[model samples]
Target: MILSVPLSLGGLIATAPSARAVPSMARQTGYECSKCHTVFPELTPYGRRFKLGAFADSSEKWDERPWTQRLPFSAALQGSRTSTSDTAAGGTGSSDFPQNDKTILQTAAIYYGGKIMDNAGALVQYNYDGIEKRWGVEMFDARYANGVTVAGREMTYGVTLNNSPTVSDIYNSTPAWGFPHTGSAATQMPAASIVDMTLASKVSGVGVYGMWDDLLYFELANYRTAKTGFFRFMALGQSWNSDELAGSVVEGNSPYWRLALQKEWGPHSVAVGTYGLVSRLKQDANVPSLGANRYRDIAYDLNYQFISGEHSASSRLTWINERQRRNNAVISEGLASNSINTLKTLRIDAHYYFRRQWGGGVQYFRTTGSTDELLYNTGDSLMGSTNGSPNTKGWIAEINYLPVTNVKLALRYTWFQQFNGASTDYVPGRNASDNNSLFLMGWVLF
Candidate 1:
């Protein structure tokens, strides 16, 4: 079936590789994986440029490449075990850890990624979520990029069509490529901002971006629900079914924008950027008469990288502020207690690596927002807030050992200092620390 799909598409689907770090790219460009990454999935300056160029850069002649080289296919597998500090209330540990202390194959994915033409490239992934027991199209990014001289300054411009907002971004500070690259399928954080992963894989976006003098960058795009047209094919096998999306329809095109300034000096590189989105969506597709809910999200981030021989280090800081206006009519309908609410998130992390084989990192994250019982409280002890406050604070620490460039083993711990606005008794008797978890994970790419 996989072979049939590519054959049916013919040359339309050509040599492509993984979106994250994979060997197919190295084989095509005649460079080692380290040339483009400080570690697996973490890009260095050169790696960022390679992606900004639409992954079209290559060392060999395109027409002369062999069939094997032309089909840059790769597969990835992930396994992990998660253990919480304490069992769930009533000994029903399944609520907190469906497969606690059990090593399970969390994910398996196949990727077709790389340059399709002289000026075009793409990355497509089909994945299986072992935990969910489902298969789906995980991510897709296709682009047409080129370089030109604008006012004597070099400018690289491109148009990106993707299923997720930040999937096409070159910076790791963004949501898609942010830290804690891999997570336990057994557990999850409760609160997240709208700009986080809320719209990932749920909508399609078409954006135009440009980088000037390798110093300034800008992008603008519009997104719409991916229920029909080409987007439907791109979004095939999504986690959300059509009926689920129907209840929260994106009424019209949502606008997204980005701007950034970056510089590199010797072994040090730095980037500062801002990005945002504005959308109006149907509060309830069941009630066509109700007004739409409006959301506005704004974010700023900073990234820094240092590289010297076998030593590499990086840091990222990002903050997102979101304002939501619930439909007044819906509020009156007992759907919400407040017509307007706000949520904000902050994340900071630092990482260090020695020879790209051994690495460690730490991350601090926090989410704070308005309190509204109808909106934030669900009455569930483990996954919900008892005080109607959307506040969570935590830190993650991890260490990794890579036997090879394509295989990684990591040990990580997450500690929650506060949850749902309180450190102790956040719920009736459960404390935030009860959710602290330890995770051990392994990955293989070939």
Candidate 2:
């Protein structure tokens, strides 16, 4: 059965028996992921048991017939604003200029999660954009897992229906589940719009493969790019000769892949992984300025965690190697272009919980690039370009309060700056200087 409801930008539904509940409910029941998961996000023997229990809890014999009849639903609402330096030009064209002051409804979503039968379950979500006046699917995952044997050893095969980013946010790193995080740098990744809320398959074909008792875990996938035209807005005009516009369609085979591994010894756990994309495209002959036939990137990340009682601390390091190859024809023609370009970034974040209700943390990020090739079309003959290459940095500090179990409220302040040697005459001016921005957001799940 399908149901719809108006929701806050970031709200999420609760249908599964294991659905998150109010803190009071959690305390009253005295249960945590540990009761189900072997290692927090990773399910364990008890975790599977809880899933089975969720199905049992919704049986016809249960007293809450209405709630048990369907799945749990959740929703979230969010608003954001920004401030920047006047030195920055919005991009190409007068229309592209970003207004110095702005307010936006960042997100609104609805989700359903629960079991379908004894050994199967599903998770589905829909997101609406107030500004766009449209709704789209964000996540639809169906999973099945059972004991099995491989190479004469015991193992399990689990399947999933969506291709969410492998590692985007640290706090809500469930991969294919959860509401949008308004304050994560990884959200800018290209895969954000393509993978989420699509009919992509993994697990049996592309999934973590290893023995349950092994100290390490790993994953592999036959990654396929999502359909083109899925995003709400296309930056470039519908001109076939426009290199910037035509290059936006990153369809065909992903040539993209991911690898993740982690090990736990006592109270310490460590994880490392890499994910990136490689693709080839045809450029418009009319627009000789755009260069390159192939674009590729490689990224690596490492994480460490120390857990003890209510106190926990974690840190992460990530590096990216992005390359844009220049087309010989374009360079010889003397159009605005470069040969090879690359971008690298490093970020560190940490969080500490106080009694599981209140917590505080900070995150820092630094990005350096070989060239300024990443550009977005914003319509009205305008484009948005990153002003700096070689260096950009940002930081976020926040405190979270969870009055009830399933709900969370947070306040955060962020600052970011970009340095550019030359600016353009778009909305503002050329020779852009570093700019700073601040934002505050609140999130909840029910």
Candidate 3:
């Protein structure tokens, strides 16, 4: 059977390759990849169940142990072509991307994923970035879980150790694994939320999470900088830079949390959830002396799915609100007339599948935030905001085909309604629409 599902990137969400499905976990459980994912990384109810089951190692044959259970290894590569309404200036001298209609080998990776022991399982991704010309850790999610009876209801509880906040989520609705899975790394994007996008690769986190009666989910965790120097070697990270490991270190104990309520009846499943992150951070390596900045981010999300016979469908909605206290930045950078600022983002997406081989979807995304000229001034360039606002609004439409189950092909177009707070004359002669982009991608897993 083929899967017609929305292809998404590391939050970007897009399509991938399809084939006989012997990628990683399938090699361990002997279950075809389709049993868990209609689209790679997107989970079926059974896939969620498998993860809650500790990847099912306790159920394996008695003679099998982690070391002998097929190794759980796989590799994949990606390439893409990107065309913008306006081309970047001059040549691709940045060494991180290609120029104009040039297609690039964007990325390649090797993964060690699936069951680690009777009660523990993990997923580790080591990737080489064609743009950065460096290799380091990309993603890691390790968990240990157990089943219990609670007031006659069944529950699955687990502990998670990972590098990013939402990397261990079974649902694809979160920031860590939402759709539009890949894009040209060289493309220029407006500035993003520091709280949500940063601290992703630089820190190590540990948390406790649980699913109760298959209806309620909760988690709590703390994060700190992954130690530099030798820790990078362990991550295949560049050995030359130590400070890069921590980036801007998390001050004190940065806390993160998640909560959700879900229900399923007949062929439909739905969920509503809330999550948050709060961190105290030192400025940058150059100015730690200025003290710390505080960021508090809160989000609400919803997910829906319908499955019957040869077809499956799903949709997700999410919104995030961030409150920031910029004591150090206000004093040192003098960019703020006020000491507090806020940022908000909203995304809504829906998809439909037919016959399990083809699919299409649409997404609307908008970001808006406080205005502070000193903080966002980019000097009349298309990349900078004409005003001191963090406003961007756009729409994306996509079509995807999964010939088998391990590969995906897709075409995506994004239209900008507003960029960096302007709909017209963002730069001297450029409107945000001038930066509209068309991206074509090919992705595969084996």
Q: Identify the leading candidate in terms of lDDT.
A: 1
Q: In model 1, which regions exceed 4 Å deviation?
A: 1-19, 61-63, 90-92, 191-195, 239-249, 284-291
Per residue, candidate 3 scores C-alpha lDDT tens digits across 65-136 of: 546555778888777777777654322123322443678776688887777767888777788776556777
Structural similarity to truth (TM-score) of each candidate:
0.91, 0.64, 0.88
What is candidate 2's CA lDDT for residue 330? Answer: 49
Q: Candidate 2 at residue 106, lDDT?
A: 49
lDDT of 1 by residue, 163-211 (tens): 8777788888877777777656445345323333545566788999999
Error of 1 at 109 (Å): 0.7
Query: For model 3, where is the 10-residue window of minimal lDDT?
Result: 1-10
Candidate numbers sorted by lDDT from highest down: 1, 3, 2
Candidate 3 global Cα RMSD: 5.5
Per-residue CA lDDT of model 2 for 357-436, tens digit only, reads: 66766767555555433322111112223432334455657666667544556565555433231223322343223233
